[model samples]
Target: MLSVALGFAGPALAWPQSLREGLFGSRPSDGRQFAAPPIARYVSEDGDVFTLDRTQPRPLLKFDNSFEVWALTPQPAPRGDTIYKNDLGEPVLRATRLGGITIFTEQRPGGSAAALAGVGSPLRLAIMGPQALLERLAQASARASRAARRLIPFEAEATPASSALIADSAMITSEAVVRMTKRADSRHFLDRILKVRLVEGRKASAQVAQGVLEVTVAPPQGLAGRPSSDRIVQVAETFR
Candidate 1:
């Protein structure tokens, strides 16, 4: 049986040995790039294994206590992207497409702006925290809470995409499950439904899930009412 014990050693899941060995290779478009599909596998702490064939946005693990989420792209990003960093000097490693959407190879989690541009989109994000395993429904709820609020105080010109979506949604689904394994009591289980709403970025909001930290964008409306592909092309061509 899969081990759900709080302190026990997690499962040992591994990608095909040959596939794992072949992942870190170069492609023709750029000398420093490589393709990310056909064989990328990330295993969760509970031995749940996720194999990447193409770039899909999904979490790596979900359980009653803890979880891990991961997003992968097929292309490689370049080396000099500024979206990889925040004003605080922390590094971000997921790519989000607002207008432009391209995926390069070398941009694992942090690529240079110059490198990231090749892949399209200026925003990239990744959220890894203690409560990473709530499943998609709960994750969406958390995201909606964080995205529904506005980040008035700004230190930079850019805004985060995930935060915008959450703020717009406002209400999070209450049915989503929140699982927990208490640190004090390993055998005990603490499961509940978490409802979150963004009150303040720096200060605590009226609604929030305890033990969960969120990473998201500032302005919540940037991604709303996104234009169609044809409209985007027309606009780009008009500028040209």
Candidate 2:
């Protein structure tokens, strides 16, 4: 069912020319060119599309039109299957060894068969100059502010050696804001947040306190480091 359910794809192009059934069990088009982490796309019966990236320590899932990234925990299921759950311990999707998939959504609590949408891109951060990185950080900040419907000032101090980390740290902060805004349990916390600041540290960490979102980044872990997107959101949730 590669039908472009929505107009997201133009008339000239269709999504997933030959989408299969089991995305997780299939191999990528060319593993040699992209010697990177795995990514998979799945669509539900209600036309909900999501991409899962296994680049991070924990698998991360993100909706096509949303900025919120969810950290998923994989649990062993019966019949050589695996169940993926969100931070709330709610099972969101399940996969079998034989390339079968079933997803649980609000519309389908009993689970719907997930269609393998297409091959996903590797979760690789683009290498850019300092100015570009700063611009990207600013863009991410503005997006988060718009999503939260508030003026959340985002700032980061970057040294010559820590420019990329600083930009990524700011991005992580902005993503956390989006994540917080999406959840009813943590959305109110964004109202109380005034600013988000990211700085270099010996280790990565994030916390929300006193109307501020503080993020610290440690290099060496490079682009895929600790204090993931949802972890920062979870930190904001703790305030409430």
The window of 10 residues in a row where model 2 has the poorest summed lDDT is 1-10
lDDT of 2 by residue, 105-161 (tens): 767989987666655544433345667666856776787889888677777776655
- Per-model clash counts, in order, read 29, 0
Top candidate on TM-score is 2
TM-score for each prediction?
A: 0.24, 0.64
The alpha-carbon root-mean-square deviation between model 2 and the true structure, to one decimal in Å, is: 7.5
Instruction: Please write out the lDDT profile of model 1 over residues 1-240, one tens digit for every residue.
Output: 111112212334333344323333334555544444322333322232333222222211112232221222123345432122212223333333321112222233333221211111112123322232223324445443343331211111122433332322221121111111112231121122123333223321122245222223233222222221122222222221
Worst 10 residues of 1 by lDDT: 113-122
